[model samples]
Target: MREDTAQEQGLDLEPPVPMEEEKEVMEEMEVEIEDPLPCLSETDTQGIIKGRDLFGYVGIEAVLDQMRRKTMKAGFEFNIMVVGQSGLGKSTLVNTLFKSKVSRKSCTPNYEEKISKTVHLQSVSHIIEEKGVKMKLTVIDTPGFGDQINNENCWEPIVKYVNEQYEKYLKEELNVNRKRRIPDSRVHCCVYFLPATGHWLRPIDVEFMRRLGKIVSIVPVIAKADTLTLEERLEFKQRIRQDLQANGIRVYPQKEYDEDAEDRILNDKIRENIPFAVVGTDKEHQVNGNKVLGRKTKWGIIEVENVAHCEFAHLRDLLIRSHLQDLKDVTHNIHYETYRVKRLNESNANGLALSPLTLENGTLEKSEAESHL
Candidate 1:
């Protein structure tokens, strides 16, 4: 058996290899190979370096300009009020803009299983100026209309507060304790938050906004925007723009408008009645002993719940660019010029010391304010 096996297990039998196989082996061995060079050429390497440099320069310039502005502008505070319907996520928006997560802490009761602790959120109206802009931003988050159990008819009370306080501030001189009082001559703006997913404008929203418009520049904030389909959201925005325009209410212009936007607006019936979404705690459940139903899912809490993502950012940007910008310009003028002239005139009328500049015919002499500043 050892002799018979073709050079058996350990034996070498090497005589009958085919010529074709040998030729194939030789050809494979003869194949040429090329070595790889660097992946990037000189030109490409330079381009990458140039782009990085350019980006660095732009970033550096932005930081420097911000620093310069901070140094030059003192903390100029402007008070703003935010009002909206209950459950429209006004609290969420406030928490987002101020980056404080105040609402989350307040809402922790809903998540807690231990001992069933309840956390009620307080009404917050705090200053949130960007550190660079320091004390410039003072945001007032007002409680929603009809939110309190006892204060169901709260409109008159809020209006009274606004009007009375504004008048008093205008009359009084700047005192240490009264610094919170912004003068009537001050430029103040209001932000009115609404659900972006629902009908363009509810009757209550419009009526309240119209009244607010008379008082200050009111921005119609489209709140809780993430839950809406893209087309529905765009249509909603267009409807709002058209309605506000028709009502003689000024809205900010968009970057671009589709020519067919007008046609789309006329077709949508935004005026159709919608049921109110009652949002409240169980303790405040029955006002006057009547249970209030919550918002329906079709156009309900989900729409308002997503507000943390969309509405707050949009509202923040709109306020900063439109209302806050105007407020800053006006505040600067008042602090530097208008207040000086008005105070001097009032003092002189009260038989106080006369300054170098004379006052005549209810107006200060030329360059009086500039000289005083």
Candidate 2:
């Protein structure tokens, strides 16, 4: 009767398949539903693939070429700070490094006449280009840093300046409509000049580097190293290294920051020769039938680029050729990140509102300022 009623309602019923056949059909459907590609679980270790493992050619290596072209077109910025007394040849050394009039002394020519009685921060920037690669190099010169009779807290201005740059960058990052590439003014490397006293670090030197080293990459160098004998230079460098360790000061290419075995090995060599004894000169003289940058004296001309004469070449290579990008990276990643976290934490603790002043300046608005904390 039910089958007759179903037929009257236009319903059709088929015989059920045997259990074994139904099971086989179900298994086939399950096979079709399975994924072809492999998937990783949460705890699965990722396999490393080498070039030899690849079956077909993929243009992955071309990414490096793309990055190189992009970097060449976009250019970059590097801000370096020179800290020392007035007559430490800081400006001269900078000019010699870049082989250009990029220092305050070269720009002003009479910068000595305008030396301030107190520690003053002066920045001079120049757009330098070579081989189609441009760099906006800014040299921050600290005049009268340790010149005063009672030079107390001479590093205050410098420390404040570094933190200020970090703060400026932080504000821009907090803005809703932040720039695609915010202008980088933060000091990347600080070339701290230590006097060639042939003695241990002085109280001022210890204090200044101790504070600044925590905030920036401090590359302490023996200024006017030509004044010291070879023996004196060695002994002085040893003493300074000991002092640095005793005072717990952190300098550039720090061991703790090394990323891998290769970096550690390279930086280990640099650490062994810390506080590079350097002589700076912009004058060129005839040497071995070739003109060379050197300092002329009654005894002989001290070739600046000659490694035997001074460690200036090593310093130049470090600051320019090899570790220039590393300096910028450390400044942005480590130093700036440390400052950013601390500032954000402070804001969270104090419940500080985003300042209207910052909003008025169009950096951050109250409604758009998101709590990074």
Candidate 3:
């Protein structure tokens, strides 16, 4: 009688539900939500994640911002080496490259204080900050190169230095406990200054670039290009390329290493204008009421920054603007990989670790490195 009275008062003992509605309520509770980027699936054989339409904000695009923040905080290191004969305006060009006094003038008498009896290696570093990003730029200058009367085997010291860097990196990597980021002192790029002789590649230049090309990224440039006529510059560049091809010298942006069609298209343009005819001057000259870094010649100012006047812009673009990171990549991937593999294979083959150096004339020199095949 009390249950009947409660039911009559509009309170049901059990809330009644329709069969179809009850089944839908149970099904909704049992359903499991899935991720859009499914890692594995019965339908996907190769396990590739295909792009899908996002229903809501997933924050995936924030990864680029995170990477940018980390890189900005860490800054960057770029080490470049300059190799050329004396008085080729190497320092001037390097300074022009950074748009600051990063490189000492080769003309300065203090620089020649030590008459380079042999090819000696030295480095200078500067911290350049641009728009909150700091770049530690180190310029390794090779003086006394080809300065001696007998310039035979002048590249020995440079080779030794490069190998020494590789050895340093290898040792760091082999350490049981290593630094979070090993200091990258390896030569990223070697800008070889070729004299504007309006001629083919010289034997010394060829030899230097060929050997260095294997170990480092080489960017050969015709220095003091203003000295040559426009016609002469074009002919000289053509001849240099021909000689380089005939001699089997590998320069930067090697066709074999092109990453994809985009890289090939961009690098093809650079290859067509290899051995850039470049002039470097840190002097600011008045051109059309504006001061430009250029040389004040009788035939107007040879604007260093002006592409119309010289190809320095092209060289700078390739070096710093367009291919700076690419050069570093090539060094780490191709050049460093070659050195690393050779060293490891030799160590394994010999059944012992090779010493860093062997004595020659009571002076320590780099052990024989495998031929860069």
Candidate 4:
């Protein structure tokens, strides 16, 4: 009937599709409907691409090698400040750690003759190279610290020095034409030595650490641990830890700074063993057909690296191997950032210009810088 109507109207119509062809088209449509193409947007799958998600080799891991090469070419700087009295083996420990005479006392022939009446800051820097890598190691020594009978405000000099370094770096950063690599004299870590008296933390110790801990990373250790018995050492460490808590002093590997679960676990172990009871010696003695770094007493030799004898190994691992980079990062990001923000805010409030004052040597004069502080 439709065909007859179309013929009467002078309209031409095409023939209908066969039943089998129609069925095949329907099957194809069903197949497409069952397995549609993905409709993912960039925002949906934007993060954390897994290895299996990659189609083929992309060579993205080569960035590590590139970074290593650059770092090797441009050596980094690490400045460590050692705070203790003269007879605490601070110089000996530093030399023992690096296997080189990098301390101020080591460099000076008559160091004992030149003891300062007040706290004096001296820094000695040396370029250390090993296995195609170079590092500029600077050891800051605080002489006459805690050495005087009337020890009043001995930490003031140390505090001033730390701020001076921060000021220097901040000045360079604020400069319009800054150096490509601003020399980092900022103290990364301050190793505070406590005498192994087998007693609680003294007032001076608590006060010094309390002030310095806020500005830099402080790692307290029992200097000359061999003087105490094993039980005495453990008890002394416990007492010191309790004192640190009661006094509200924050030491390194602080709980709040843990970055992740893994870091927390590792640092928790270190925290439990805080204020490592360490013995330092530059002399080596023959034991078991091999030479070992140790101090010889009348009874036997006390091995410095042996865990059973002393915790120097743990201290070394923490400072050099495990948390070295973290120390640097904390110095720059946490300590220095805090100082920078405070200084900038003060300048803003005072309506002072951001431009740094400079002396003839293109550096801030010590007196002028400390005046601001």
Candidate 5:
């Protein structure tokens, strides 16, 4: 066919391109190819390709020692609050709690100093050190708690004090450049001193614990337990536990907070022995020809540290021994975390927490939260 007729009839009369031109055209073609996956060296037991495990130790376990040394140098904070009415041996118990923890090998006698009643809040701190480990122990005591005839809202001051400490910690946390270790003045535990009433929990006791249980860890104790007989004490404890459960009061080692099976088992034992009947005494009496910490009674000597005589040892063990650090953890992780979430939510609700952090030149605008925090 003629070239003109071939073009109209869809027939090619032109010669093909050269091999070099064809190769150039093929190379110039912008074809998108799907990317192949990376190669896997080995699979773990779970079929995951993480890196190969090295033989021998890398001394990563030394981080624990490093943390220990760092913490030993930095020290730590333990804040406790003792809440109850006067004449419950709150002062004596506080002394006993601290004194028993000290090393007797090089320790001097603990001088008896009267803890005067304050109409308001009072916090006392002492740096306790043992075996190169230092702890800043602060004890908060209220003198006029339930001292008024019409003790209405007596928990206001105590609640205010606890929240204030949390606020201080939160403020430090919210700072643009916070310290490596913020001073933790937050109350780790509140030892609620309940009078040795042979009967059930009183209205004052119920009210106080009901309000305070939400914000802090409360470890209720039966003060002057030496007065109650063993049977009476057991009955009273059962009643108090019932009242606590009925009122929805949360105490230390609460069931919902069991981290694991071991924790649950241990805390279950403590829960069974809740509201430990405790007796405190600074004076020592001669018992069995040996000087021991006990109250000199006309009938016989009531040993303060003796588990048979009272639950003071149990209370002490729970507070200063096994559950001490756990108390602080619960305060920080659970109670303080709850407060923090609510406060953050409130700040957002109040338009204080801005989206994208509403910053200008890395400066925050003044708000009510700034002052409160």
Candidate 6:
């Protein structure tokens, strides 16, 4: 067909276009391609990739942050000592509770074989996370007061030093940045551990408790109780009641009563402290009820069975639930004072003072009024 007729009929009569000419035509019609803006910038993209790469580390960091915040919020250091006659398993009891090894061995007179000798005090600290509440429990293992080699009179001096250290911490470390300092005694609490089978109120225990009473609130715990029979336990409780009553302590079951009566009752007691409910368990011991020394129960030895069954649980609850916040505040102040004094000592260790050759200046320097003013 003629080219004009082919065109009218909608057909091509022309030869195939050259390859290079077709490519040029296509290129002329093609749209230019430019790089598209990404959803994230280069920096943001890198961050996202890094976050994906370190998901585990990120999670751990988050947990660490939470723990740090909790530590700051619950900034109280409670130093609890377990005291009793030697060989009563004070070290074992503390190690079991705090889940940390705190032990010592005799090396010389008045010396133990831990980090430092000389009846070195051992302590174990652990954190308990429950129901989102984080708590730190520090247990200090003290030498059983009447050590044969440490000298019978070692107990008094140690107690005095502890009190003095507490005072030093309060006046120095507790308030390094604050304008005022709080007393140290407000932060320390004492626990007296007694053997489950020993004489109800040993003279030594009584004397130590009496002295401790003058300084801080003291809690008495009957240790290694699984060794005693139900009847013996009951009798032991009664004897403790009598002895403490003689010393001005009141023993009573947990119950509701008139405020006036409670106050009067507490005031009448020697330490004004009641015996926590008696606790016993069969786990820490190897023998059956008769010969087994006793065992650590699911309920703390101090809180056997349950709160309803043990007075120590009630006492513990009172201290943990009621006094923990106040204790934290007090302990923070004490640590601040301790830190402050330590810094002062370090600064003055070379025999330099703010003023020399004047006792008046020294006295006034230590006083709150003078320093603050």
Best by lDDT: 4
Greater-TM-score candidate between 3 and 5: 3
The CA lDDT at 188 in model 2 is: 98
Q: Taking the tens digit of each residue's C-alpha lDDT, what string does model 4 give over 192-274?
A: 99998998888899999998899999999999999999899999999999999999999998898899999999999999889
TM-score of 4: 0.86
TM-score of each model, in listed order: 0.45, 0.85, 0.83, 0.86, 0.76, 0.48
Task: Give me candidate 2's TM-score against the actual structure.
Answer: 0.85
Clashing pairs in 1: none
For lDDT, candidate 5 versus 6, the one ahead is 5
lDDT of 5 at 239: 94
What is the TM-score (0 to 1) of candidate 6? 0.48
Could you tell me which 10 consecutive residues in candidate 6 have the lowest summed lDDT? 250-259
What does each candidate score in C-alpha RMSD?
23.7, 7.2, 9.2, 6.0, 8.8, 18.7
**TM-score rank order:** 4, 2, 3, 5, 6, 1
Each model's backbone clash number? 0, 0, 0, 0, 0, 25
Candidate 5: deviation at residue 59, Å? 3.3
lDDT of 6 at 91: 58
Residue 226 CA displacement from its true place in model 4, Å: 0.6
- Model 6 per-residue lDDT tens digits across residues 24-131: 999999997754533355546442345555436545558888876776666434555566666555555444433344333321257543322234455555566555
- Candidate 2 C-alpha lDDT tens digits along 1-373: 9989999999999987999999998988874454343444466677556677677899999999999899899999999999988788998899999998889889985454555788879899999999999899999998878888998767777777787788788878888898999999999999999999998899999988888887899999999999999999999999999999999999888998999999999999888889999999888999989999999999999999999999999899899999999999999999999877766665677677545353233322211232121
lDDT of 5 by residue, 1-373 (tens): 5878988999876697999999998988969664343344355244332335444657777999999999899888888888888778887888887764332211336644344343477777778898999999887878788777777677776777777677777777888888987989999999999998788888888988888898899999999998889999999999999999999999987999888999999999999999999988777788789998888889899998898999888888898889888999999998899877866776787776522243221122322233243
User: Where does candidate 3 have its weakest 10-residue lDDT segment?
Assistant: 358-367
For model 6, what is the error of residue 319's alpha carbon versus the real structure, in angstroms, after optimal superposition?
Answer: 4.4
> Which lDDT value does model 1 have at 151?
39
